[model samples]
Target: MTTLTYKADHHWRFSPILWGALVVAAVAVYLIFQDGVHLMVRWWQRDEYSHGYLIPLIALYLIWQRSDVLSRIRFDGSWVGPAIITLGLVVGLVGELATIYTVVQYAFLIVLYGAALSLVGPTAFRIIAIPMLILFFMIPLPGFLYNNLSSQLQLISSEIGVAVIRLFGISVYLEGNVIDLGGYRLQVVEACSGLRYLFPLMTLGFIVAYFYRAPLWKRLVIFVSTAPITVLMNSFRIGVIGVTVEYFGEEAAEGFLHDFEGWVVFMACFGVLFVEMWLLLRITGDKRPLSEVFAIDSPQKAQENEDTSARHLPTPFLSSVALLIVAVFGAASLAERQEIIPEREEFVTLPKELGGWRGRVEIMEQIYLDTLKLTDYRIINYTTDTEFVNFYSAYYDSQRKGASIHSPKTCLPGDGWRFNEIETHAVDGVTMGGKPLIVNRVLMTKGDRRQLVYYWFQGRSRIITNEYAAKWFIFWDALFNNRTDGALVRLVTPIREGADAAVADERLQEFTKELSKVLPEYIPG
Candidate 1:
């Protein structure tokens, strides 16, 4: 077998041009940090993402542990690194303009990977890829995806928790994400969605997989199983909390013991991860101890490997670095320039009387208003002797920041409503200028009560049906017209017992026709 080794060589290997490139790269990173400081703020404030602070430290340690192998590899930079660097810069620019931190963070990681490839060769890139990729777990999911996932996970965890409570001979009833233990009620809000455990455990799982001296498939299995393991353990935590609250008082679920239980559950998750590693060793007949299976570098070896690495002088990498620096300055300048928000009528001025229907405005509580973070909104109920329709609109003047319209699909289930069916309904005559107007038609039920809801996104100059499409248009319009104004309009009417579904549909269509006429003045289509 051919054996390769690196003797301790502590001298610098970069040429004058490469040294200049290094300075440019540092400038680029400083620009990125200007925008990325918010992530640090979020790490401190958001409990679920607090692990963000530790991710970089862990990733760095992993990369250091592999130093011995990386030092021996030859360095030949590739032009592909520059191409990737340019892509990352462009993505970062877009993200900064759109004011979406998730996109900006992804662009930052991509740029870092490109920089690594430019500093070393493809072999070193492959060796350090896992540790680099593990850094991704630090970026929080976008609001829309987070809301959808959190809502689903909350429901699933609640169901499993209630089932577990019953298994322990405690009578329990589940309504959506609400668990009723006859006397005490536990509502599974977004905080208890188990994402807190999932994010950190997945990060730990990747680190374990990197160190485990096993086959490729075995490593993947150990990594992939973290998700299911997190879900199961989190459900058990909720079940245990419910049982405690039933036996003791509500204080058990809220005070110091509650926090103590969370820590215990997290420790149990780690214990389970170690047990999994042990089982895999037994199955593969490796006969190695669990500690040895996932061993790290010794101090002597790490010190030896930390001496220095050979460097290459590549024109493409240097050129890419220069261009990236230029792009960073450009993005920073663009961020400083004020965006032109279009002047339009506000939803607060919406008329109470639309055509013949009598309307009454419903005011929201200050707490809900604060949570929604909307610019303006209206929740008006229009009624006739035979039927009642509720109209709601949430408007955002500038969606450049984190503020934007939320999808009702994510919000509906939290209030004990189960969706029976959802589909897009096309209304031909009800559209503006005789164009086809598409809206989401949904049927939701709770116990024996049922409601039909019709909703659509009213953008600057277009009416949209799909939520994803609305996001695309928001980005597009924000880019071109410098306008990110949009609003969500929803009309809901209850289907009375023994009432015909067709009649309710007709009533909504007729109301939408009148709505199309008055929406433009307020929403400015």
Candidate 2:
């Protein structure tokens, strides 16, 4: 009997033409995605997304880890690559027209995927797909979505934290997101919403799951468990703070101790994730040590006698590169197109007295002015013989970059106000541009006080009540009319003790009627 042994031999080689094409493609991609990339980098400066800086490096490392398998795969590009690149370019154009960088960021990722697929083709692309997907973790959520999520997490964490505080036999009253500990009220502000931990931990979990050699279901569980783990750990930290503050002092919840506690809790969350992975392994009857099971395997080196050869550049890859070059030119043209900021009267010129109401203009705090980033704003308290209404209007000369009109639905909750009721309501006798003036009517409560609010987004010859509708119109007008300027007009009044809600509603309607008449000069709709 004769036994024959066969050894596999392969080598990685790229022709000079392919290298030149790659350089051109890279420059084109950077030019086309520079705006979105810059936006993402800016967002990374924030606490919740600081992890963005490390994601790309990790993706590169992950791809490097697969170099052994990649070395053997032939670089035959696919037609699908150009199709995907075209699709990404189309999406990017829409994003640019709308001045929404978040959409553009997603399109950048799609184009990157297409470029990779074009370079390596389907057979090898599959090997590095997860690493490619890991790049997505670098992008931040859109402002509107981030605000909504932060508000929801704040409420959830507050409720759980309050429950934890009760476990220590402390008397605590929960109102919206506030934790009233009789003397010291702990407001569960956006900072304590656990997002700072959640985002980073989720990214870590995803990376861990990718490396974990386990059943698919088990890997998913490991990845998904990060969210709950973060929430629970953060809530527990808040509870400990509450208990410490009750026994020690308010200082327990501030300064060094507060920051240190956060660090500890985050570390504990990581520990918990590891323990979960161990438990999962044990449950599956795997007795190997945890370190041995979960590890980064080094890429195997190519044999010394491996054959090295160079092939011509694929047509599909050339097509993808050509598409990117055209996209870069298109993007440059769009960048030159300036938004139309219509001339409007300053908020200072708004009437101090309207009809029967006497108005007192109030200055916003420096902190709020910094946060809002509005071109102009006015806050007036208008009072009549028996009622008072608070009038607020925030104008943005342009909402193209990152600055935008904050929706009350997100802002109110962060201020410890809970929405009791919200709906669209049309004023009986008020008209805007020959149409009935419609507004978002909101009844919000904070502790024992309740307030009725009426607000609408006025811009580009449109009065919009829905926040989403406002965004859509901003996109539409930005594309067609070269305008993304808008203002949020809000009228609010308290429902006094022993007063009917209808009374407050009537006060807002009356104030809105007067306010709408003069709104055009300021909002320029």
Candidate 3:
């Protein structure tokens, strides 16, 4: 016993006590940065934070097991300590510059803990580094990735929500990703999607795994099941609400089911957690040397020695690590702020005149001269006008026209919609932002309800485009030039002065026939 005690007293390893303090400090930082967690939380959160708090306590509790090695730990100052500290400081500064606040701050703690491990000698270095590298999971993903996740969540939740409704024996019809529940429609809004629970639940699961000193297989089971469990339970909750509404009444669903139900569902999740814990314990056979779990820590010394005490590392090693740290911090900082280059406009030439119709297509004085022999002429320049002062070309109009087809013309509230029809009386062209557009007055309708449609078409430069035009750019050429130069005919059809899709289609067909006389090749029969 005395010989073993002597060896324990002389051995050096990364002290659990140091690990505990570092964990406490990290928890403190997170609590302090609560206002900014939205930016900081990328990879891991709930897992890391709770672990931070628990590890210290566990280390203290487990101190007895480590007593053999305790006396061997001695204060040894090394150049690596200052180097790590310096590297951490640099990481924080660069993170601040790029706004990757979480990673930069976390880097300091990682280096501090890692360097302290170094003091335990190379063996301790490898042992500690092996587990500590899991810190990478804590970093937040880039914004683009988050968006994709969000979209996926939206789709999955929306679809599953409808299925849940049907499973409740409620007559539900799903069309084009929309769920129709009797007269009311529930569009799984982004907030209602399961993604909100994903990050949080995964975090909770990881922390729970670390809390139980379960074997690797046990931890894997808990971790992998996190998201599926959360999403499935949430779907059940939504399904219950739909059942209540269909059978009991809307008041049952909206008044009680919709509003104050989150708490109840959350409680349900916790219940499932208890069951999960019980199962895990049974499956893994709780060999709970509690202190080893890092949750119930053994009492630790108030302060511990640094790992890098008196060690010399190659400059190249330091350089490579620094570069990697800088890269991670940089990525975290630029997550949401990538610069997008604006699209350049395309241009084309057109004839000065058409046969029989003088000045049908204008040739401006600021002209790049070109001539063609045809009975009719049209200008296909991208600009709305040839006038250098105002600069007009039908090409810009044509481009914007097709592109706007992709977006909903109706504003979120529908107040922006207007309708108009062709009339002999000329109305003044309206300029929006800095660009001018032709304003036509037409009648409008919504869902079989009739109303007038007063709409405006901007020629695509210096103009505030409508919700539709701003969204799509595919139509610029079709409206500006004769896409299918028809058998040389010219005619016009004034559509109904309204916002009805039915009316718009009829008008479009008639209007196409008018222009088809000039260019009939592109239009489908």
Candidate 4:
């Protein structure tokens, strides 16, 4: 018998490269602290992003699992790493000036990846690439992209959920996202919009894919399948809630059970993912047991004594210097760029009468105002002898951060009003500060009641109909003019019991003509 003995070598030595790397990391972290805080706070508050907190830990654990392989690779420092770091800093500077936290967060990850690449060359980077790529799941999607995705997901989930409810022999009426179920109405708000499941599940699927010792195609399928699985499962959850409400009353869909149901649904999503993997394995004639699928055992633990040589620490001096310069520049830019809160009269005294239409001012609840985060707003019920319309204008002095305008497409569904159609309508021969004015013409209905709404985003010197276009202008204006002032101006009129929508349209169009004249005074076009 041969006896093999291995020495456990443990040593701590601070090299110049290590110190340089630490200094660079410390400076980078310090510069991105504000963005980091905002992201963590959002993770705590937003359920969709709650999984963000665990992504980094998981990534680190993954790297540790492959430590043996990583440890053996010698660091071949590259100048490209410094170049990437410079690009990341430039991105952070742009985000800081624009007040877009998402950009900063993304830049933070880029800088982190660049730092790793700087210390270890391309070979080592490829070895630990998955963990670094996993960092992307931590950054929240930009607001514009999130809104569009949420809208589409909400609609898809709502449609499928309603179909499920119908299959259960429940009498259901679906208009947009509102489900009318005789006794209880279900509005598939943002929470029920599938994003609550998609984000977390996508993160989970990525992790599972990383661990799954399978063919590349199998792993890819497992990861990409999370989206549709999330959507389908969320829709099923909604359907289950509908059935519960039908039998057990609305209380079944609220309170503790509701929260529990969400957990159960998420767990079900995990089960579905596993089932998918199993089926794929069967299709490929791979007979590996499910238990044997995960590659969780650390390679370093298995082969520790095989190698004990100390490799020289390759300090990324160029990258470190570049990062330091960028951090300093970013901090200076942020400190110097003042938030331009342009002076404008408040919206309190909008007017009692406009274009011969009498108006009555109404106040929004404090809770709504808090959520809106607008600098000022005005809500008024304008009426004439034969027509009544609601005029609302919410103003944000600075929209680069939170408290931006909410699209009616997102808000109206929550109020049990289902939008039937929403399209951009160019209001010919009308102008705001002598520019073409376009508006989104929306037709919404709640049961038998119908309403016609016309709304547009009023940014400085622009009357935009598209919400995304408004976001673009906000970014451009924020960068060029140091201003992100904008307002969502909406006019809603009822399509009276027997009256045609055309009548309501005429009333809103006439009111808008008068509105365009005075909006510049308060909104500061």
Candidate 5:
């Protein structure tokens, strides 16, 4: 009896003091990461990130399922916990300074990891580590990455969807991301990019892989197969919509039918995952029933004779909590620091006529306005005797939040344009900051239509051609200059049918020279 009692006492159990400390730590974490958490929740409202709402609950469930194993381990806190917590705090500070909430969101996860390690030490932490890592699925990708991914997925889905349509003995033409089916045209927009299914199915696959009783390689296959499964299933759904629309008119692709098709495809993806698992099991010579192969054992109950002594709070955990409290104060201080928005002329004041070119201003639709979230913008078509150029500029007073300039490289591809060549070119006659103007020069095509384009990012007296460099400057300026103001200046000209592309290039360069002189007034150095 004495030996049994001693063995039971060796096992760690949460006491009232520990529970109270956990509650305090939770509150501190909330206070420190409230802004990022709120933004994450807001992102959950979008279809692609809607699965975020379930990730936390699933993570908790995973931990709860392992409680039996957790209860057997002793809580010997390690100094590594405090070190990790310090690292997390430093990362959070950088995020706060840069005003990038995505960085702060990741830092929150890092701090939680440290806090968990501080409380339970390395032994028990290993048991719960995967579940903790799973929490990362809840955060949304950065806007630029998401746009680029969505564009690629859109193009893939469109091509596959058109192929599926052709397999049905129906004629279809594919140009970039658009599917032209004689009577009707279908543009594979961002919503149809398969990401909505990809994210949720990937999360589900990860959880399934954790529970699956199989060889390591087989479990990995189950998880990784989710991507191709989602893409193929989503493409099939699109193809089915096209076939239906061909017979039943445009109504087949709108309202309830379109949404119902999405649901069906997502369900089909799940079915495919299960089928793949079964195949893998067969290949491995496992003849056990599918139900038995995927085990989710109930947590074991504690013995009545176990020790019930109250455990003291660990010093590492207390230190972690103290660090979080300090972070709360730091975050509050950051919130008090207001960003500076410099005075600049609105795009409406931009000159219409310049350098012997006549211009016509164009109004963007409400959908684009909402998506761009620009403070001001100007879109105009400038024409000469035998040449024409399209000019567009977007400005943001503050890019601290998610609303930043969208790169033309990403946006153009989504609009059914394929990039043929991309390079940096310096306009000889045009200058910025007493240097030759350098811009991202691109030759893109959609079917037979070819266009020559030039664009660059202007911010904080810096002219940047690289998208990543622009982002770095935004972070740098936000931290030191207390400003995130920026603008995207783009010029485009169509290469007339059977004409040399060089003429269009010359037209854009000439127009760029004149436009550069006037842009400083609106975009500001």
Candidate 6:
């Protein structure tokens, strides 16, 4: 028996050409990590939370996959490595200066590719690059995509929640984002609209894909599951909140549970994911693990085959210095976006789908959008330098159905106090279970005068559920806080600002366009 002893006689051959890749990779990580904060900040400006827990996880996963290759490759004292490092660093600096996340993203990718090419060679680089790039999905979507998704989820949530509640023998109705139960009414606020879960779902999807090494079929199944999971769980959540009022009284579901219960729904979603994995495994008994099927484990064999096949090129890497210049300019551009936004109006050009809702709005007001999905609306004028928030108090009293009976608060900016105003008007709106979208607007007053308005421009699909509370929780804050202080635009209006009152609508329109995303309805149709 030839005793295959461990190699004491073999020398680790380090390629100076390739060893340079590590420096390039390091510089890449630094640039990405730093810009990551700014990019995330932009997301936050658009009301999206940025989480960083997944980056290290993805990095580790990649490194682990390449451990076999790394074990044999050597680090020779090579100027080539330093040169690559310097090039990557220069690119990173350029990207940073440009403030362009895309440039940053591109720079990061180039560094990754360059490093992988130098260190691991062609076959290994090809095998690793795609999975590594897929990791980009872990980052939160930009504001535009998030807003679009929120609308879709809002429409879907409203329809589903209304259906579920009605089936449970509850007399429920919906309009736009609002839901009406026997003694309970809710407007599916931002938290209930599914934004919170959407990002996590995206992250979860990526993780599931990575860990399962799933085939397209398996991955698709996993991806598809997020929809029903979000919808049904949200429905159940809504039902729970509705029933909680019946059993524990309305106030019981009002505070923390109303806001934090979304985490519970999210956890419940995980159970569904796990079960799906189990089912997939059970279904594929005796078949290949997805990783094996996708040749995830075949890097060594792949490298050997490709080398023998001679189907790859070994061209020397060109200087990425030129690309680095482009990245720098791009970074500078991103920095420009960091500047403060200008003031604007609140009334968005409601799309035709939501246009009919302009007339259909019966009562528009801001609510916590928590346990109770609906509330009366109100409009508060802050410009009055009165002793007792007079403009808002009277505004609240007048629009009894439209205004929420709450103190001054804010959701936007300036020294604002948020207030709710409900306005009722009849108009066409998409409806399920006999609930129609209503029209209305509420203003958050700042320093007792200027206002950031909250208008439910279209109320065609108010669906309510507790599971989606996370998405709408932030919305509740905006309502209760009255588009609260921090960063925002403000316009002072008279105490009786309303549609028929001939209020100057331009400023408010500017606010919404500049501050908030597109109206939750208005799906481009």
Worst 10 residues of 6 by lDDT: 391-400
**Which runs of model 2 end up more than 4 angstroms from their true locations?**
1-7, 261-264
Candidate 4: list runs displaced more than 4 Å.
Answer: 1-20, 253-259, 302-310, 313-319, 361-373, 409-429, 434-436, 442-451, 494-505
**lDDT tens digits by residue: candidate 2, 81-145:** 99999989889889888888889999999999999888788887888899989888888887667
Query: Model-by-model lDDT, in order?
Result: 0.77, 0.85, 0.42, 0.77, 0.85, 0.44
Question: Residue-wise lDDT of candidate 6 within 1-525, one digit each (tens)?
Answer: 011211222223435543454355355355444565455445443222443455546656766676555433332122243355456555654544433343345455556556445444444445466556654654454322444555556656767767766666767666555676667776566667766665576567656765666667787788777767767777667666665655676787575346745567778887788777767876888365534533444223223322221111123332343333444455555544432212322233322121111211122333443311222222233221221111111111111111221212212211224354434322233332244433234554433343333333222123222212312432343333222111111223444333332243443333333222443322111
Q: Give a tens-digit lDDT track for model 5, residues 149-216.
A: 88789889998988888888988988778888887888887888899899988998998899998888
Model 2 deviation from the true structure expressed as Cα RMSD, one decimal place: 3.2
Give the per-residue lDDT of model 1 (tens digit) for 1-525: 013323344423456666777887877766764565566446535667777888888888878776766655555667888888878878877876766666877888888888878767576678788889988888887767776888888888888888888888988888888889777788887767787778778888888888888999998998899888877887887788778877887787665336744556677888898999899888878898877778887423435434554466666667667777677767767766566666777777777777777789999888557546788899999887766889999888877555668788877887778879889999758775345788899988999898889998987778888999998898888667777788888999898877777778988887888778887777766
- Candidate number with greatest TM-score: 5
State which candidate, 1 or 5, has the greater TM-score: 5
Candidate 6 achieves a global lDDT of 0.44
Ranked candidates, highest TM-score first? 5, 2, 1, 4, 6, 3
How well does each candidate superpose onto the true structure, as a TM-score? 0.88, 0.94, 0.45, 0.87, 0.95, 0.51
Off by over 4 Å in 3: 1-139, 175-178, 256-267, 280-525
Q: Summarize candidate 3's per-residue lDDT along 1-525 as a digit string, tens digits.
A: 235222332434444555554455344434433323444432233322233334334433334434434434443333454466456556654443333344454654555553444344343343344345444444554332343454455556556776888876679865423456887665554445565566556655665665566678877777788877767776676676677778888777777545634446555665676577677665667765434453544434433443323223333333434444554454455444432222322222322222222223345332211111122223321111311111122222221111111111222112222333332212233223323323333444333344322333322232223433432222232223222111111122223344444454343333323222432122111
Candidate number that wins on lDDT, 2 or 6: 2
For candidate 4, lDDT tens digit of each residue in 1-525? 011111334322345666766686767555654654476457546788888888889888888877765655556566777778778877877877777677778777777777777776777678788887987987777665776677678778888988898887998988777778888887776677788878889989998998899988889999999999999988887787788888788886764236745667789899999899889888999898988986578664534345454445555645566556657665865676687776777888677788889999998988667556788899999998988989999998887654478888777775668879989887766788788888899999988999998999886888888877888888788878888888999989999899888887778888888887787888877
Better of 3 and 5 by TM-score: 5
**Ranked candidates (lDDT, high to low):** 2, 5, 4, 1, 6, 3
